[model samples]
Target: MLPVGAGAIGTQARTADSPVMRMLDELNHPATAAHILAERTMLHMLRGHCNSPIAGYADTTPDGRMSLFGMVFKRDGSAFVRSHAWGDPSDPATLGSRVAADLLHQGAMKLIDATRK
Candidate 1:
């Protein structure tokens, strides 16, 4: 499946004033943008991109806590490391940064570097 294209469509689907966007907003589901921000922040800290073998996901609980997961993989898919963290939903950037730190401490950066050799 075209995850990238699908992501683009999902982004557009959340645009303000659209019917879907309005419904989501009314339903308190506007957290998609927040999740994106958290994931992007984590990726930035890891120096990863959409084309990289790095992945992350973030979400908030009804209690207002944000959880994030980050993973980095070797090019041949032989090795990887992943980490998870939680923080205040209003400060998702911190949640992401912490998760990235955990992954790095787990030697995720080493695996990523190995892939370049």
Candidate 2:
């Protein structure tokens, strides 16, 4: 584990050059990879086939208390969570504002992924 938190650092930002818009981008890790892992973990655990828990995380603050989970689930109702840890202790508003926005982006991706099938 990367301490209690190290995922979140720096304020969230937007760049016009962004080719794709995913809030998970608020952190540096690839959301797709993290999501896939979460899905696999969730499915395996739920189905009793999991080798181990697949917990991945990113910093939302730097050492904050709270994690943004990328728990992945499919249209079939199988899923897992990808988590982002907070960088520091923060108010719910700060956590919700920054984290939620990015998660919303991630949720949209999940929908699209479901639709692709």
Candidate 3:
């Protein structure tokens, strides 16, 4: 079987005041968090859902910059739009937004809309 993509694991607490949550948060790796958050933010900006033909990945470069790559594909896999960008690791959301906007500007929405029908 082919691999669809990578998955992210996260933890939540009933309340923000929980000491266990704080500890877990502290143990979080900044680079990994940035990568995941950046990808998630791109998907969010694109309004991507489980049914949408959207894919995205984010990672940190060896020099510590954050890079995001995103794509929107037609349902039949006949066409697609893609965008990539690199930005500061400390501001991953901006990188995500930038790449998403690039894809949108390139008619990603058309591909996304076609998938719904």
> Which candidate has the top score in TM-score?
3
The CA root-mean-square deviation of candidate 1, after full C-alpha superposition on the true structure, stands at: 4.8
lDDT per residue as tens, model 2, 1-117: 321122434334466646444553655554333333333332333232222222333323344354444333344546533434343333333433344345444553454245454
lDDT tens digits, residue span 25-109, model 3: 8877778788877887888888776778888888888998888888888888888888889999999889989998999999988
lDDT of each: 0.70, 0.38, 0.80
lDDT of 1 by residue, 1-117 (tens): 111112522434646668887665565544666677777777777776455678777768777888777778877878778887778877777877888888888887777666555
Error of 3 at 86 (Å): 0.2
Question: What's the lDDT for candidate 2?
Answer: 0.38
How many pairs in model 2 have backbone atoms within 3 A of each other, for residues 3 or more apart or on separate chains, i.e. clashes?
A: 19
- Model 3: residues with Cα > 4 Å off, grouped in runs: 1-5
Candidate 3 vs. true structure, TM-score? 0.86
Question: Residue 3 error for model 2, in Å?
Answer: 24
Q: Higher-lDDT candidate among 1 and 3?
A: 3
Measured by lDDT, the strongest candidate is 3
